[model samples]
Target: MSYRGPNVVATSNADEKTPAASRDNRTRSATTDFLDPLTETEGLDLVGILSSVDETAYVWDLTTGRLDWESNAAEILGFDDTRKVATGAAFHALIAPEHLNSRLEVFSRSVGADRVRGVPYRLQYRLRPCGQRSETEIRVEDQGRWWPGADGHAVRARGVIRIMHEEYLEQQRQLVRNDFDELTGQLNRVRLTDALGAVLTRAEREYQPCAFLMISVNNLAVINETFGIEIGDQIIAEVGRRIRSKQRGGDVIGRYSSNKFGLVMLGCGPGALRVAAERFIKAVRETTIKTSFAQMTATISLGGVIIPDQAKSVHEAVNFALRALDIAKSKRFDCFVAHEQLPPAEGARLRNKSIAEGVIAALDDHRMRLVLQPMVSTKTGKPEIYEALLRMERPDGSLVSAGEFVPIAEQLGLSRLIDRRTLELTVDLLKRHHELTLSVNVSGLTCSDAEWLTTLRRLTAGNPDVLRRMIVEITETVALEELDQSVNFVDTLNELGCRVAIDDFGAGYTSFKNLKRLNVDMVKIDGAFVKNLADDTSDQIFVKTMIDLANSFGMETVAEWVGDERSARFLKDAGITYMQGYYYGMPFDSSDYVKAA
Candidate 1:
């Protein structure tokens, strides 16, 4: 066994009282199989194998002021001889400057006189290759322990050092790829959400205004169909590049989806964010993008909303931006839309968000209740079918109306829950009152939603009589939008003995051809026209035309929002068979309905 080097230090003052002979004996015993390069025993041979690989075995003899390094250490440090790399400071020099101190601390703990026996020493850090910038650093994994003399003073430190540059770089690349979108080289959805969450938290803490912009390339599908997907991809890439170029220094930008980019701007209020959104829209619209087969200018729509002011979370902010973006796309091209502040009566996006959250919580807690508004037969002047409406019981003991939360629920995709709940409640109500009939409003989405369809099948199949008493009222807009699905749905309902009614009938431009094909049982005149039927001759004519059309198609007509006696009388004289509004009776909850009965 031998130890050879000039870089190690002798045990310091703490070990000065130990006899020289005793220290020599301890050093000899500790260096035995560890220093014997040819030792073939299990642990001894393990060191030899490690040294043969890309790892180096090193030993610092504290008592002799020497350092011994194996051949691998010299090779890794780009030296032909061990001496060139064996100096005490040479290893420290190879470490990146930022890591040098930490590396030294680990070493100090392992070899320091005060360090107790069995204290572990392990460190992983980057090493700057000679003549290269710090950016091109390599990783080194070090593990070793300090051994003490019989007198209890540390005299030697030995360990294995592995060059892990390639492995570490591969790991880093994999991590980056996971966090970023490959095509656009921008943060992907998951990573973008995490980044936004962090920014939101920080902004809240600092009381700074932050904003989010949802930028979408308009009609990307049309481009793909016309020019090919390759050209569409090129356009998307170019748009990402332009967004990156225009984004401010501290702003965070990411590819939120295939054709959408998300931008988080710090210190931006509503006005500043609107200006930024305008610039972004102009930048993309003005830039000419060249692809392999085509060159064209692309238009973008941007929706921006101030954080904490417009929304409190990434989910809410993104939703608000998306809503604004939808409005922009529908209203104008190559334009920016900022979430607007509206009068309290209008119930802006934030209010909708609050309502949505409350609706979700209420649904989770089974706090939603059904109220029925009676629809009276104009000819008989008697209540026949009661329209089931949704109401939510808030935590504050206040009740929210159907008009307030129904639209918000649909917007948040929570209408499916409301529909299912309403169906269940209506079925229970019908079971209790055999002669009672109820018209339930269902989202057009339910016709195609697999879960809702399955649920409907189950509920109706249980009792065919319940189906006979149910009239499913679907909105005219939805019926027209999902014409094919709505037609099939109405047919299915009719086969189940349930009648179907088209709601808000006058709002949409559904043609008579499509109307006859739907085979619905009734048309509920939209409140917009019926509300002013008493005074407005145009509304009067519109309502009369709807009734005549319904009668011609063998479908009954129900006038909605018949709030005044004049409106009801006008609707009745105009041949409306049923009327629904405060003129009949305001919507009443089940408890009130039971008491009234």
Candidate 2:
């Protein structure tokens, strides 16, 4: 018997002219004899068993590249003739190009491994039958073991190949589901962003133009409230469909958020971006959407940023587009706004970027330090407690005050780190100095930061003295913004034995009811009203009223920004418990203050 194919020599089984050929023939004979018992069993249906599982067993002669398969190999592999898969080279030719390398790599890596018992391998790949195109390709899972020859190379492999057409189809469907939005049948946000990054790279390399637009359906919330959420969803789906229809072949669109869609337009310049945005807005606006409950007219607002011109990176592209979209919405319904870099905003962005880098570096380099500002007792003219102020030292040793970086840190979501560090330093100081009473400010963001609270709990745990002497100060505006969360935060601090003070109080003109609800231990008068208390009658009345109300609630009042003897005397006469300002003393380095004390 002889086998013939492309890249394969017609070899006679009886010839065995070479040692490798002789070994291959012997291996084949041994494999066939091993399966002969199964075929001879009268009651056991071997072919039926293999067919039931859509599997075909094979013994591969690696040295001769010859392949021997079970009787059902051709039927299971969807080949018209068994000769099509008679050798490894022919079988490799049938493997889909995309998966060919993977199949080869698996076997290559298996070579030289422990082959006494054989090296086991399993892989999945697609195979195209002879005369069949890729659309009709069959997916098969091939799992087997191979034995190495004396040369430490794979010489023989015996394995089972199971057709996985159904599983392959399911996997393809799952991939589609993962890469596409269910409602819009468009690329999902993750895939769309990936595509955006790819296009941006191409644009930058080719020096072409691209634009990313953020289109928001203008009254989605109102529609949801007036009709129903189901109707709102219908509107969103319809809008997505309309936007997709208007997109160019090369353009990509995705549901970016609930009411917003992101469109990435290729080779589009500033002029083209505006035109595309208007076209998309018109597509959704000109036609009314028919929903389950009612027919509604939905208008969309568009904001876009041209790539490499107005935005350089994916993050900048998304943010700038959203910013333009906000401006468009503010102007009117069915509006289009293209992002133009404003000097001040650009400067601020650059400043923030620098600050963010500096902040992270400072934290890593242990350059963050605390300065103590004394809040003095107005009656005794003595420091009662010190407020811990955050300061970052530059590489040059110049200190950056909290006023410069704290707001930016909060905006950049770096406040939590700073807040945690502050807590640790404050607790440390309190533990070291038995006479020290310190106040540390907590950002509004930290109130919701469970990790920060956990850190606080861990540091002050079982240290009642430290907790009692520490005051957790929260600004009045922050407290009033989220009254319930603020109340809860204060309650937790109180429970932990830490005193809670409403800092910059009277700044928000906090209602008496809300103030009482806070249940705080003290209120720090807003400095704006206290600094000119002696000269400004209105400041005096506001301060006096705040003091009276705070006193009535049994809450102590600490006047801030008191800069003169008259203001300090007036605060003392007005029942102020403490006063803090330049008039009392400037902020001292915590270490220096500790040494001096």
Candidate 3:
């Protein structure tokens, strides 16, 4: 070994102690191979792994202050031979330009020192030429480090730097490719745009209702102003988590923008939409989380569009949902306003252009119709009352069921027209017959529109029989969620001589601590319990308890989905006063409804 370079820097005064010299003497007398590049790189241990490409092994010479031998270390540097030609400086030739300084520092430190610290360092360099050169260069870098051998100078360094380098590169690619919201680790707008089409296709195939909701962290702007953007961001992150925890795994949720999250509600029908909205609202508002600076609480406002039909395309559904979200944002900060149902206001005219143009035409052309579903009396074993179901006929001469298009109509602010048309049909049917009562299910959203409700009463004016015969079913969750506004709604209906039933008794997302919290005349049990009653003892017990509980509170109990004689008998015996199901009768037109009733 020899050195032809300038004078080398010796170890510091502190390093040239007596202990280090004694250790050096011990390394030379160990009777080990002095410098076998192969043994040092490959035969350092009994394990063949020491010879593997991942172990970076090199032979260094203290006297020369340079590498004397590197056994297949050339393989680590993108070659097969390290002992010939390139020799000592070959390793330095492959050192990446960026790592040149660090490599020099480590080499200088190792020579008159206790140890050669790094077995290998990562560097990207072109590969050995396999054929005629091409325009592109094949370069890779592998990463590895070292530990001192049994003796300091006689150290072996071995490891693969290419795969390691590639691994880190891949991680960088993923960091850029991911659609994660930086604040919450939730899916962001980038993910939503990509996944919407796939989700729509599945819903179309399954004949399921798919809803898209846009949720805003209400008062977020105020939060930023009052506290700070950092706290506001913290609140949004917490709100995102709460929303995620509330949903099932398969449901797609993402942050559409700052303070706004998008949700694709799966398998939800129009009948259950208000319930779903109230739940999403509750999930975010009810979350109490403490940040570093303050204890924070939040409310979320939501707006969403239910799928047009299982057959509708993904693009259509996304546009619809986004439309609804816009409407919700234009309204009160702490409220969810469906886009299609936004009243006549700025931009509403622009938003509702297509639906509004077609809806009035559809109505004028008698494209609107009604389908009455029976909600039979449990006691009489006869249909005591019929539920008025709405329907719309598309231009293709096909009827879109109320469960299908009422939401769209509502989103277009055309629900009052729907309500009016339905009432007229219902009354015309009633006048043509006698002894049949009809229950109309209306959106609790309309509860706040006094002019709309007043129009409803005036249209049905001079028809006390119609009013007395009507049971206006508003979802209990919806009423309770909007409790402050519901009082006036209840009073207005009572003045119109209408009986109000709080629909879906215990199906609320919030636990019912006060069964009679929202004053109402009757409680309808959610169909979930009744559907499983035949096999699930828990459901049987729940239904029985619900009935007993409702009776105790002077409210009538209606068991929905009573699909068989056994279910009907069990519910009747359970003291349920009302039952509704396919086994009883499917939805019919006004004439069939009256005849059946």
Candidate 4:
């Protein structure tokens, strides 16, 4: 046999049957015989499978410069079955113009390299079939190898092409589902965190600035309870819509939590972020949410800090915002508070963070302790009840006061834990000492929490005696914010033989209006008014008015922050029935106090 081609070599099989020649020819013939049946079976299977799958198969006769494909190829290309073959030029034209050069380069390199290495050629490229106006595109994976004919003069390329349209579509759908929140169609938390981190890293690299804001729909739980969950969802969706509409370019927004969302503003300085934060607050506050139940206006609170400078990581940035949001909620709704507005010292911030962490640990480890601050009754001139105060035992044998960590616990949504802990401690203490009466303070947030209410019910169910000696102090802020719930709580406590006190009574602005709604046994005037009772005339007047109001309502009054005998005498002469302050005694371990008595 003889061959004449650029990639072909000539060889002879005409020699007579010499022993050496016979062995060599027999080896070649045996190899050829083995491959013939294998190739025939594979080719038939490939054809059958491709035809059944409605796929395309093609062969390139390199010597004749012809491209021939299976009949289905014409249909796949949006053409008639009659045109099942094309020359190289027509085959090349099937590729999209934009992908043509790149496709050709890839094909050439793949084939050339494989040919050098005696390997098969394979590639994937985008194809927009020619002679059609459908404008549809498909990804085709080509697999081919060089094949030589019997004469060694014909070189051909055979391959199979598979369309990847379905695969590509599925991949796109998966990406969408992964990155988007199904309820609000916003970025989900995981993707949002990733994007925010990316932006933070880029901003740091470029020496730019960014800001993050954590926004929450205020009292979403109340809305869900009053209306239905459907209405609450509509409110959240509307909030997302308003935020998207008001977003500046390059701002990323995501659903951070159930009722909270986050915003990332790229290259935003503090002043710019403040203005933007105000705008966002206004936008959501002004938009009225229309649900099936009723139309309602909602307010959102924003708490955030500048990134890359103030916050070094995503977690820190979010914590900064969370800390601010806690302050905002404490002050008023529809407000924006930046992290810098908090304590300026890094030590303060670290302490707050550590306190937040300690709360979580304390909840799990049962490390919460209670102390008793004696409340002396002027009528009896002796301590009648002790206020239960929360203290966290530190790892280093120290204690953290509630004043330092209670707000943090509230901010971190651990108030209910604290409330439950207090109840447990109070129950234990009351069981230990039959003569000791104790008061425990609960946050306004806890008053509205269903879990906390359940906990309260459970605590009172087993031991009715505990309720007789227990005084549950609901803060003035909580009572005012959730007046209806607070009233119900007070009524339930009274019915159970438990006394209720309006704690920090004059701290909130709605004291006068809401105090009448609360049918309680005692009112603890806020320490702010009592702290300066000896000198400040206005403080004295406020305290006097509060005491008179409580007396008129048939509620006993207790004055706090009476730091000296003068203040104590002042409260005593003002008809304050009880006095609790440093002057009487500081908070001491409740267990020890009960034991000493």
Candidate 5:
């Protein structure tokens, strides 16, 4: 068998035009099919039985000129997942190159005259997980025994089926979910917590010091924004698999952040963390993650902590381990840093105080003013309605951007108030300017607030125009992850004659999935790539592609950071429909825009 050979191609065996009754009997019963997963009795369904069998099992026949594949078999066999597998040349293209020859060899033996009946052939099987791995193959054997049943039709011979108890199945599923990041398919927070915690406790019980390693990628937000979430998830998954392969036994590792991973050491001390950290850094630097683009590398800041008593509650120790990771991140350490080396804080007081006070001052003086930035019609060069910007004034009467205050408000439990203030201000602003459409920013936590919704309803009750001309820029980064609330918020807003735009469109956990399902109107390109638009060809291609993408979906694209003429011109010529920038205007007083006009 060869990579280019047509002889190995599999053909579809599925009946394209079979009778309904025949299909029904061959397929799982409707109830069993509709209810994902079957009860013990329902497991008798043929489809259910197929699903319950080995994940990679395929009813393959190289002798059959036609290639046909089962959908489950395709997923297990590393092919493009389809309704049913196909046989023939096209099917061979999807098989892992390493497995094809061996599979063909097995086919030769399974059908030959010398092959003993009921004999099972053990094969080392590798099913590449679409893109995550090279085929983490498990060795399994194929047993062949055929019998003429009462109907005189041939069927595969097997033993009595042992149905798993419902409770056991549910528990297994929960365990899998706990251990995996759904987006990246790497281990998630819960899994990491359990795995690392166990390692730490065991180490402590053994009275041996253990190390914890944490790795975080920088500019993940920008990467996510540039590529869209589907690609970002792929990159993250690849990085995780690489790291996992490098770690030795007794070390537990899992996704710790949207762009970070945590590792726990069993017996290795501080030195082990150091060694593993070095290996990780090297792997990350040398390795290029495969996305739609062929190659890309990520920069990671790593940190570690060594606990002398590994068994004495490593969970809390993980916190200390995280603190070190933060230190490494904040310091921009290219390599790894240890926990003991952390510097004492000069209080980060100025930062926290500025955030806390900024909100308080904005609320007290009503400095939280809503300024509208038009999402202008690219075709008409006229206003399409404006997106809302919330500006705050300090005690000095200087205007502060939301960037400087939003994070602080969130940390201090004041985002809901800020959101309410912004919404109220937006409504009032709309009342004053009936011709303008205003967009307001709402965070995840705010969207989940019932009181805020009531506040919004009340504010817009008396003025229909205020409600009609309003658009809310819900940041995809926040809104999509908390899907139910996000959808409800958008539905309510839409009912109130408001539209919703996904803010920071590509910079989130599940951008593509959200775009496909999220109830949103427009996409705001994040400012980072736009900040350096003209000079970076890669960034330009990225931005241009996203603009095209939004247009294809009947959504408008807004170029953020249209900071200067150069970027504005670049974005404008690149077919971007709308641009927002300091070049056109810094978010200013409504009076300033009016005066300028």
Candidate 6:
């Protein structure tokens, strides 16, 4: 280190100092000089302190392009000689190729004003030793202050270089964790989805073929139930490993969900997709997963869609692949289904998309209205309760029935929203109309949705009268599907002073045992059995048996679809508690009913 300019000093008169005063003055002068500029000995001490922490200080003279580094620069930067890093140009050459321009841009950015103090900068990059291309490249953090020259450009900089290899490695690990699944070590769903979109774009641009496969572990739910979830996770991890081993070099695999994986195969046509699917299937089926608890054989079902062919976008590709997966699962435990763009299916898909958009818009716009259909008492033929059916009013002043869009809503995972909205409307109606009793149907998805129950409790909280007038109806099929959850749901409703009815009863083979366990308040016989009850003896017997069963359980029975006087009379004679049908009255808008009342 060298000083190249005149040094300014403050001098005291020699006549003013006594012998003792001279000693004190000398001590003060030494301290004052240390602050002006570091002497050679002090500079060496600073270098020693910085070097102990793996840091090196430097001073660059921009006009001369000379870099003066501390004495330990060679040792700190892993260089054999100090000359290699003694100049700005020589030092810049050692910066990794990718980081060279970025490091230079830091100084260039500090060109204008703000030189009153100095422009400060901090950046991290890799540096490779000169003439050595090995994995030992150093990661460094360079932070410094630059001063402007007369031309308003950076002329000199003072900074420190810190070795950041450990921090850099930790950051790399975090990136891996973000992009990959913890259990399977495969790409996570988010990264996989991004990768799918990218591959689809590339395939379209390059006019190449590719395929996306959604592979699901068959009977995973049963496995999780039979074994523990931990063992199930182990199975999933092992399956991911097997899939990775069988994938081609260009293919990508990711953990799509708990029991499913998504694979993207580049340059794969429909025929190649089938072959690849089979290869993956065979790999998992042939090898039994050995876990610490137990060894079990697992098989996977796959659904595939060709890129830029069957599907063009990421959304379409994922949806189509899931559809194919459903078909494969329905066929058997281990099967592969390839998505085909049939005309009818395409039309249905478009229609579903339109309905989904409409549903969302209607909900947002508060266009979801309820229609009330009367369920009349069997003995006196007077309206007992009104069933609230969901309807979406269109912009054209027409209405779309729940049947037209509810299934799609369920498929698109919008049932919970609709259900919550319905609960709110029903509670409001019950509060407004003191003489009204209403039954509202819920989808299967809502049966297990804790949020829906929370919403229900919130809406009817402190208003037990409203809950008492409200009847929550769940389909018989849904109730039997997850009997335990349905039982709990029914119990909660009953506990809240609300009645639970198994709607569309007798549609599914509901065992008397399960029906008894459900402990519902009412069973609405399937309209199919009630519509022809007057003429069809079989229908009459089934209806009679269902009525008998309900009566035995001390549950009320509501006969639905009683289209004519004869059906109603027969249902009433068969001891039905309530009857609902067009013959009694068509469903009318609840607001209109309110106005009439």
lDDT of 5: 0.65
Off-target runs (Cα >4 Å) in candidate 3 are: 1-360, 509-517, 594-597
How far off is residue 436 in model 5, in Å?
1.6
TM-score of 5: 0.41
Q: With candidate 2 superimposed using the best TM-score fit, by how many Å does residue 575's alpha carbon deviate from the native?
A: 0.9
What are the C-alpha RMSDs, in order, of all predicted structures? 18.3, 18.9, 20.4, 20.2, 25.8, 20.3
Q: Residues 1-597, candidate 3, lDDT per residue (tens digit)?
A: 322233122322322243645434433322133334545776664223434534333334333323322333434444543322222333444444564455445433444344545444555444332222333234555344433444443233333434235666688668756867777887778788567667677777776777777788877899999999999999988888888887866788888889888887777766566687787788766657788787878888777777646226555666666666666767765666654543468446654566666678878987777777777776667777777777777786777677655666787678777676776776666666677677777775677776667666676775788778878887777787788687668777777787788777767743444455555677889898888788889998988888888788788878887788888888888899888888888876665653554
Per-residue lDDT of candidate 6, residues 23-95 (tens digit): 3453334223322266444544565676788887777766566566665666887876545455576677678
Q: Give the Cα lDDT of each candidate.
A: 0.78, 0.84, 0.65, 0.76, 0.65, 0.84
Please report how far candidate 6 places residue 249 from its true position, in Å.
63
Candidate 2 to truth, TM: 0.44
How do all models score by TM-score? Answer: 0.43, 0.44, 0.40, 0.42, 0.41, 0.44
Candidate 4 worst ten-residue window by lDDT: 6-15
What local lDDT does model 5 show for residue 138?
30
Tens digits of per-residue lDDT for model 1 on 176-209? Answer: 8898898898889888878888889988999998
What is the lDDT for 409 in model 3?
A: 75
In the range 144-216, model 4's lDDT, one tens digit per residue, is 5655454432356656677767876588689989998988999999998998899989988999989999989
Candidate 6 regions exceeding 4 Å error are: 1-342, 595-597
Question: What are the per-residue Cα lDDT tens digits for candidate 5 across 498-517?
Answer: 77788876677355656757
